[model samples]
Target chain A: VARPRIEQAQQHLDSLTKPPGSLGRLEEVAARIAAMHPEGKPQIRKRGVFLFAADHGVVVEQVSAYPQEVTAQMVLNFLQGGAAINVLARHAGAEVTVIDMGVNHNFDRQLPLLHKKITKGTGNLRRGPAMTREQAEAALTVGVELATQAQRDGIDLIGTGDMGIGNTTASAAILSVLSGHAPEAITGHGTGIDAATRRHKVAVIEDALRLHQLDPTDPIDVLAKVGGFEIAGIAGLILGAAAQALPVVIDGVVSIAAATVAYQLKPDVVDYLFASHNSTEPACRAGFQILGQEPLLDLQMRLGEGTGAILAMNLIEAAVKIYSEMATFDTAGVSRKQLP
Target chain B: VARPRIEQAQQHLDSLTKPPGSLGRLEEVAARIAAMHPEGKPQIRKRGVFLFAADHGVVVEQVSAYPQEVTAQMVLNFLQGGAAINVLARHAGAEVTVIDMGVNHNFDRQLPLLHKKITKGTGNLRRGPAMTREQAEAALTVGVELATQAQRDGIDLIGTGDMGIGNTTASAAILSVLSGHAPEAITGHGTGIDAATRRHKVAVIEDALRLHQLDPTDPIDVLAKVGGFEIAGIAGLILGAAAQALPVVIDGVVSIAAATVAYQLKPDVVDYLFASHNSTEPACRAGFQILGQEPLLDLQMRLGEGTGAILAMNLIEAAVKIYSEMATFDTAGVSRKQLP
Candidate 1:
């Protein structure tokens, strides 16, 4: 990150119409974006929300509230601009890209989507590895390619979204293996499951963690062992955004799992990342703690289709507008009033 | 508020292509707006951020970080569209209105603002009443008139902002008297004061509260004794918005004080009020708890220029857009395969 540019932006913000640092996190956002530019001016006009879709074999254990088929169905919903992500992305004027990473169902070849399924979803995670190491690598590679495609399309900012049934279980399992948090403590109601089902979900994650014994030191081992393909894809997207020096607003639980994967691989990539909101999913809190960045909003949103991310991207735009449009003390002819 | 309309909107939201209640507070916003309209559909396209500027006689006690002159200078900044409120309101596509209720500094007759100076600022609260009861009523009438003017101009949503140098001290006094919290407990650095100055500010408020012997049950007496004109103006705005059946997005410290006054006067107005963000001011937390309404955002923002409220208006717009534009499960051919 351009430290000098960030400092310059803060200096400029202090000279604007409000008290020093009174704009709070919005000012930090503007300063962070200022560092992204060469002239110390923040510019993030174009945005894209990448909605990765896949399925988890652990649905056989009823770990999720929705069925595995809902993943492909929601992918179709995204292609039709009918999902929650599409609504929010459109609100933010961000383009939506639906990537089918490893959905069990096959989408039509002409569905105006990227069909990159890896092994038709992974083995039932409660029994064995979710996917082989090579499959996980391929999923991450897919995310990187999509992010590269976003850059080629002149996207200045990118957001992460996900749609995969039984994925929260996969995410909680990943967080448990990596962060050493108990699965029962981190697991939550994915799509509003009952208490007994939640307890069962926690148990499934525990069994999967015990079965895999994934290496916490290696992000890839953890991802391949327990993470969903959509999760791995988001990890790839974060790394790709970092490589391209574009800011990425990460969404809810599954995306946080992906962020954890990306963060473990390269801690420095945190600069290019923005935690969108505190998801209701407990694993998201654990993931945020591991990633070490505060979210912009806390609306208790946990839909996980980049809805929170896109909403936050709008705030980023507002922050940048304030940075660019607000008159300085000299221009406004206001005194630089400060307390002694 | 129309409870049936709110329930109808919530039902509509559940039918959309996401899990029930997954959108969290955004869903609540949409439902609330839906209750405002005749039909169950939500609509809040027009927004106005009312910036009420005044001065405080308590500045003689050195309770604030800036000078009393800053009240009028910031008012001029608002007039010239150069203040933080101007920048943020422009970002939200909301209109900015500068109301000089009692700024002490005389703006020219031709300055495009509502110059309704009640007493050229209130008396020193540490020694005596902040204003006569009649003067407090006049300040509140100014807010009601502004809100009514907004309605005449087709603004469907309104926000409250404050600009008075020592108003936080006045606000702390009002909150302390009303909620029975100590001056030191709710007092904070208004415009970034030093520790000794903050300690002195608490002492000043304590002295003022003691000198007034204000009635806790009577909000008007509280306003007349300790509140600034801008605070009264915001209280009137909240009441006016409720009368017009328009939503009021309440801003930071002074606005919350105004809200507490409004809530004390007419508790049902809480339905029309949206706590925009959790203000960093400790008094604001007590204010929210007293009002019994949760803030939409918690960005640690303390700038009281309706910055947070305007930002939150953007989110409400997003929520309404989602309500209006998203496809339903039936429309999108997605099964409502929710957990039993």
Candidate 2:
């Protein structure tokens, strides 16, 4: 973030009507937007969310509660505008883009898919790496290119989303490696698994981390060893947004894990990112801790269709509006308190 | 709240596409709306918020950061649609009604004020009781009658807000009396007071509580002894809404103090309340703990012009819409997971 712009924003906010620092986090949000673009009034007039839909080979471990086909089905659901993200994005006045990163199914040739599939799906991480290092880099490049595309298309703010069944196992494995926490400690019942399935998922993640023995400092190695293709894509998106100086709102655990990888790659990405929710997933908290970012909201929502991103977009818009529109104490003729 | 409708609402929510209880507090919000209606659908199409602007003689004790004139000035700001509440209420699709419970200044007769001023302001609680028992009961009756009028005007939901200079001092006093906490423990800087002013505010509250020596269980006695008119009005609004089965969203610490008093008067009023934020005020948390309520959001907001209530109205509307409009698993043809 630009420190000069942030200081300017704070000074501006302190002069607004009502008490100094009274608007709380909303004031911080306005300052963040100002830091992102210091020259003129910053606004989120055009919003775009990239929903990276892929299949996780880890599903073969029976770690998730739902079938893998739900991933492709949800992608179609997105195109048909029937998913939660579509509803919430519309509510937030944002557009949704579905990127076919590594789904196992083929779509119609005419469908509006970003079509950057690195592979049909990632390899089963329990026995081997989820993907080749080259594939991970390619997925990350896809994210970078998509973010550039969004900015070129006049998208002011970007949001990260994921739609892949059993991807939580991959996310947990990545988090366990990065956060140095035991797999059981960072694991949660993703998509509402039963106790037995949750334990099995934990074991799968534990086994993957033990087998991979990847270096934590190298984000690409982590992504190739245990991360999903969509996760790498999300990381790429974060880097792309940071390079272009656009604010990106991150969704839940999977997205935060991606952001963790992105932050490791380019620490400046942290300045351009806004976290969405403290998801019910335990791993998400660990990932956020690693990134040193606090989520703007915590609704206990685990339905990660970028719903949290959309809800946060509303607040971001409000922050920008308040910063731009609210009359200052001088303009409103509101008297300041006399301190003793 | 209607128990039968709450049961039916849970049944309906279980049939949704997401995991059971995945939405967390949002589901509880939907359930509350269902219980309020207990019929085909519960919707808050017409939302109303009452902003009770009053003055407190306790300002003579140097207990507030802002001057007493701000109470009436903010009321005029509300009437002119130039305050935070106005912006937020428009964003939430809610209407605002400024009720002059006891503003020190008089407004133009044609300025659309709910003019029910109770003696221009309350007496200094440091010297004696804030108001007589008859005046406390009268102010509460005004709240009851206003709620009835709102329901008659087709307002589906109600929100509580306050605009008083030293109302937080009065609110802290009420909370200190009722929760058995020391004044220093409950008192916080209202409107961003300096350290010395905050300390003095706490001392004034302590002196008032000792002077009153009122009964904690008797809410009316507590209000008559230490509460401001707007606090009593909020309590009365909550009770009236509960009697009519309307869900009322509360703003912050002052509203929580009012809700605490209402909860004491009729414990079932808890069922009809939707808390807005986990205010930064320590007394607000104590008040919520007393009422067994959790706020829906925590934005660190301390501004008390119904801004929090308006933001909460947006979520309440979303909850109602999701409950009534979102497709169920059976309707959406989404398969449920087979649990072991």
DockQ of each candidate relative to the true complex = 0.68, 0.52
How far residue A18's Cα lies from its native spot in candidate 1, in Å, is 1.9
Report, to 2 decimal places, the DockQ of model 1.
0.68
List the global CA lDDT of all models.
Answer: 0.87, 0.86
Please write out the lDDT profile of model 2 over residues B46-130, one tens digit for every residue. 9999999888989988887788887887787788776777767766668899999988997887898899988799999999989
Name the candidate that leads on lDDT.
Answer: 1
List candidate 1 segments past 4 Å from native: none
Give the range of the ten consecutive residues with the poorest summed lDDT in model 2 chain B. Answer: B331-340
Q: Could you give the TM-score of chain B for each candidate, in order?
A: 0.98, 0.98
lDDT of 2 by residue, A9-128 (tens): 999888877788888888898898977777788877799989998898989889988888778877877787766777667656789999999999888868887888888899999989
Q: Please provide TM-scores, in order, for all candidate models, with all chains considered together.
A: 0.97, 0.96
Best by TM-score: 1
**Candidate 1 colliding pairs:** none
